[model samples]
Target: MDIYINKIHYPINNLGAGTRLGIWFQGCPIRCSGCVNRDTWEAGEEYRLDYEEFIRALLSFENLDSADGVTITGGEPFAQPRALLELAGFLRKRIKGDILVYSGYAYDELKKKYPDILKSIDVLISEPFIESAGDRLLWRGSDNQKIRLLSKKASAVYGRGIDRAEWKGRRMQFSIVGDSLYMIGIPGRGDMEKLYEVMKKRGIDFEHA
Candidate 1:
């Protein structure tokens, strides 16, 4: 199996509970308006990697064991159901961490189309990014998105206070991977503009990814 990925990062604290391994898929059919990861919206040959190679690379990371979970975000992870399934299966077998997947497709729709996925992942953050819906939820881009706890572990970890009332604020983590700077996590409306303005004054120009 081969996977197309934008990048992979470890010890990601903003995307999920505790530290996590974050995998950014390289293609998205649901190119949501105001998506911060516009650079990940397209798939290309340059992003291709053999699935085994990817696993080997992950195993090589010395801090991989420190991660509390795995966050599979995209360009819409459900867009590649087969690879997603394989990746999830691998994680379930070897990683022991909770598997969380994000999708632009609604939960009900995904349950109908890719029912098998429910067995592989622990949590699902579903629904498209609605630019006008506003960012009022934790770990979500918009209020319309739904977080479904698909496994017992997820329920135990996230079931208690997973609602708007529990939303404190959106948090972001910055990491420099190779030559690109990744801004990980959901950012509220106007946040990017404010960040850009702040960076501009400091003479550091940034292009959105």
Candidate 2:
């Protein structure tokens, strides 16, 4: 099996509960409006890799074992349902950490269409990013999104939570992939503009950011 990917980033603290291995799958049918990750909207073979090779590449990172979990975001992970499940199987069987996913699919629809995949992961952040609803929740993009627990560990971390970030502590991180700079995180409103301004001061032109 092959996984079409946008990028894989690690030790990211803002996307999930802790430092995580972040995998951004390529292609999104959901295409929620005003999404900052427009770069990931198309399915491309540019970053395609054999599933086994991808697994090996991740394990090659020396610090991976220290990560709290693996976070799978997209490009709508379920858009490539088979590949997503295959990779999820591999990760769940081989790794010792939790597995998390973000999808634009409604929770009930996900259960109907991808129950097995849902059962494999520890956390799920679901529903499309509704730009108008304007959410400030932990690990969610919009007020309409749902953060669910598929494993005991998830409940332990997120139980009794409200739809607001602990401190409006929205954050993002930058990394280099194949000579291109990519960002990872859930940014708040206007945060990208501020980030662009900061990048400008450093001589990095990110006006589209």
Candidate 3:
């Protein structure tokens, strides 16, 4: 199996609780307005990676086992259900942490369409990003999206109450990979603009993804 990938980064703290490995899928069918990851909206052939190759790449990370969880975001993870199933299954077997996925599709839609895929995922943040809805919580892009604890592990880790478990403020992490600056996390309204200005003052030419 081949999966289209945008990039994979380890030890990402902004996407979920504790240190995590963040996998961003390369394609999104639902291109939500005001999305920060515009660069990942296309399903380009260059992003394809064989399943074995992908595993080898991940296993190469020396601290992979130390990660607290795995966050699967997009380009919309549900856009490629088969690949996601394979990826999530592999991660489930390889990591001790829970699996979290973000999607533009609603919970009911995903539950109906991809029950098998959801089996491998521990937590899900679902719903399309609504630009005008405004930001309201952590681990979400907008107010319309919801966090669902899908597995027993997730329920324990996140507690029975989702809102209480996610009371912290939203945050962003910056990483430099091969001369490209990758911004990881959910940014609030106007957050990117503020970051751009700050980076400019430091003489770094920053561009939004």
TM-scores, all candidates, are: 0.94, 0.89, 0.93
How would you encode candidate 1's per-residue C-alpha lDDT over 1-209 as one tens digit per residue? Answer: 78888988887887777889999998999888888889888889999999889889878877666678899998888888899998888888877678999999988889999988878999888999999996778888889988888899998877756745335766788988678788888888899999999999999997776
- TM-score-wise, the better of 1 and 2 is 1
lDDT of 2 by residue, 97-193 (tens): 7888999989989999999999888888888898888666777767788777788877776564633445365676888867678877777777778
Candidate 1 all-Cα RMSD: 1.4
Query: Per-residue alpha-carbon lDDT of model 3 for 33-123, expressed as tens digits?
Result: 8999899999899999997898899899877799999999989889889889988889999999999999999888988999999888999
User: Residue 54's C-alpha lDDT in candidate 2?
Assistant: 84
Model 2: residues >4 Å from true position, as ranges? 162-167, 197-204, 207-209
In the order shown, what is each candidate's alpha-carbon RMSD? Answer: 1.4, 2.2, 1.7
| Least accurate 10 contiguous residues by lDDT in model 2 | 160-169
At residue 33, candidate 1 shows an lDDT of 83
Task: Provide backbone clash counts, one per model.
Answer: 0, 0, 0
* Ranking of models by TM-score: 1, 3, 2
